[model samples]
Target: MRIVFLLCSFLSLFFASELITPLPLHINYDKSKAILGKKLFFDPVLSKDNTISCAHCHNLQEGGDDGLEVSVGIDGKLGSINAPTVLNSVYNIAQFWDGRAKNLQAQAIEPIHNPVEMGIEDTKALLKKLKNNGYEKLFFEVYTDGLSLKNLVDAIAEFEKALITPNSRFDRYLKGESILSQEELSGYELFKSIGCISCHNGILLGGNFYQKVGIYEPYYADENLGRFSVTKLEEDKYYFKVPTLRNISKTAPYLHHGKVTSLKDTIQIMAYHQLGRELETLERDLIYKFLLTLDGDIPEILNEK
Candidate 1:
């Protein structure tokens, strides 16, 4: 057992020189605020009709998404784009498909007043309702301000910050604590050699930067000419913030539009569209298995709650 352990450790160190790094086991987050945020996240009171919460779209139990192509908002109002997983979302450069919101705190409040989403007729009324529901004390307990928009977004953002799923199988492999089969390792090598790592690098593996969605060819999505609407720059058209693949297997249907449902198909389409190369059947299979290793445990607050 000791010899086996040492060999595994050596291999981990040997293979740890990849582009992507492992997520830390713990993240710094405000616990009391996060707890309040958890309640807010799960509570359906945020919507105008009392039907939708933030969790309505990003269901933590279902890989932080509601298993829909485009998440519906209050009163069956359809949102234009796919709802990205909230898990590890704090790692993103910006929020939303067009990168509209700059941070999670900013992102949390948009839906509340949006005509489609939470659809609150009045923000003040929502606060008043929360206060009436005795959330004032809860908010005061966390942020002396209590139940205000600032405190609400802050608390919710704190919970999101703690949503990191550390120590995936690939992360264990990176840390030299676990072994990858030859097929998995081969797929990983292909992942590196084929240039997937350029955008899909760093701890969150693809959230750090924006890239053209279809470098080799034009890609049409449900978005309004991709990021161009945000920047109003013609050059920015067709560009998208590359999404994290941290829990890729769970957070499907894939892409900004949720167009592809199958992991194999997404991989193949990406290889051809982004890399301009079609992966062989064996290569796609191996890579798919490797991507599966990204699935890991959710945050402790989610489990404990």
Candidate 2:
């Protein structure tokens, strides 16, 4: 019995090392471009009515999401999907819930053009507004070509690249710099042994790949077809890019549909629908405690004046 326990422990450690990694303390980004992008991200002039900005949906101050079931856009228009957290978004394999946009640069300009979101009707008009609103000089400071739509999104992407949150308690524990509580440790062990680590592995812990929402049971289908909208493939239906679990505690109103607000309920739902298991109340509680360790320090870039 003791030998069996030691072998299990050894295998667990091996899988943990192969499956998960600690986030880096810092990543490279063009600071000047990111600073300019920060300004543009908060500026409402990008909208047609000049009332909405990127920050309106992605509130960097908390959770990197707006805390809405679905985002409210320009002129009180409601979006179809929940806003994914911008925190550590740089690590995602692709952007948006649908994976429609290829990268952050592609993702940055999308809401500006979406009718219900930023609602910019004319690219030329937006350029004029930016030039008149002192953005031309800012663009010149960062880019030799001055202001343009390409550069605009490029700068925003650069800023998003710097939005990685590092040094979470889990990450410190992974690095052997800190230790988890007994409950947290047990919860993490369950996380790996129970197959959560199969999909939710990697630095950001679940952003690395796409997965179908319901495997064991049927999750209710909605108008949003997920990646099927992007690829037009039958197999792609209901397959969305698995979101990062980093800061899962802060970004409430979980999932692509944003139907579940309680993290415990979300856990139960995932267990039943995805894992085909019904967790006891105590198991859910311990998993919740483990998840809390994922909340990390805010990006230092947000602190820049």
Candidate 3:
């Protein structure tokens, strides 16, 4: 009877809609690279002021973002877009809301040189400075050639690759752990039944593709061009890459513009604009609970400084 029950459980897992991602979980990331990356991530040498680092925006302890609606850059200038979490970003098909970057390696250099963000005009000059500084020794220990612009990017990218937050309750359930509470199970069902899975389907849970922010209604009262700004294609207008829901409970002021503060409000907006369905108060709460399950523990190193 126990063997029969196990077989039935296995079959049920196969039939579950949640386990649909094409990518398998990757283990065994490089610790030395991650350590180098972490230092570079926190070091303000990457910024113009030597005050801002990647941690300024993608703060790990604060749900991988600094909890601002829009991020403040160097000289306290506020950016127009909301900062997304750095966690589980390794799973994303592309980086940035408009899919501007092909990988973490390419994504690493943009902010360092962005006049708004880091304010560094020349990456070579920055690397020369870093090479003469303390991280140079560490880089020499880690890499054969030491701290070049390419190696700096490589270290940061390596650290980002190690930022995966695995073993969520959903992942455990997928691995046949049978651990989700009744409310969580119901919430997961509702997540699927309401077609949230249509876009949010993946290991990263929504980073796999792009979708229009408002399909049914015009979302733009103020004309934020979204993907059109990147592509200059009419079809790409208002089409932003679907953000991963991993650590969703932490990474809010939600949405692209950071207009919505509450998850309940964000859900209502998404339901109305994207789904054409009005979520009841209780249903909204349930979906929120399921989203909370996506909040896994943060990496210990991120919290230290």
Task: Give me the candidate number with maximum lDDT.
Answer: 2
How accurate locally, in lDDT, is each candidate?
A: 0.83, 0.88, 0.80
Q: In model 3, which runs have C-alpha deviations exceeding 4 angstroms?
A: 1-26, 300-305
- Prediction 2 global C-alpha lDDT: 0.88
lDDT (Cα, tens digit) per residue for candidate 2, span 1-305: 33553454456556766788988999988999999999999999999899999999999988999999999999899999999999898888999888888899999888999999999889998999999999999999999999999999999999999898889999999989657899998788778766677668889888888877886787874678788998999988888998889999999999998888999999898888877899999998888899999988999899885
Q: What would the per-residue lDDT of candidate 3 be over residues 1-305, giving only the tens digit for each residue?
A: 33553353355445547544433355466778878998899888888778889998998877888799888889988787888888878888899999899999999999898887888987777977787678789988999998888888888988888777776777777677888888888888887766677667678778888888877566883457777888899989988999988878888788988878898899888888877789999899888888887766666545533
Which order, best to worst by TM-score?
Answer: 2, 1, 3
**Candidate 1 or 3, higher TM-score?**
1
Q: State the local distance difference test value for candidate 1.
A: 0.83
List TM-scores for all candidates, in order.
0.92, 0.94, 0.89
Worst 10 residues of 2 by lDDT: 1-10
**How many clashes show up in model 1?**
1
Clashing residue pairs in candidate 3 are none
Model 2 spans > 4 angstroms off: 1-14
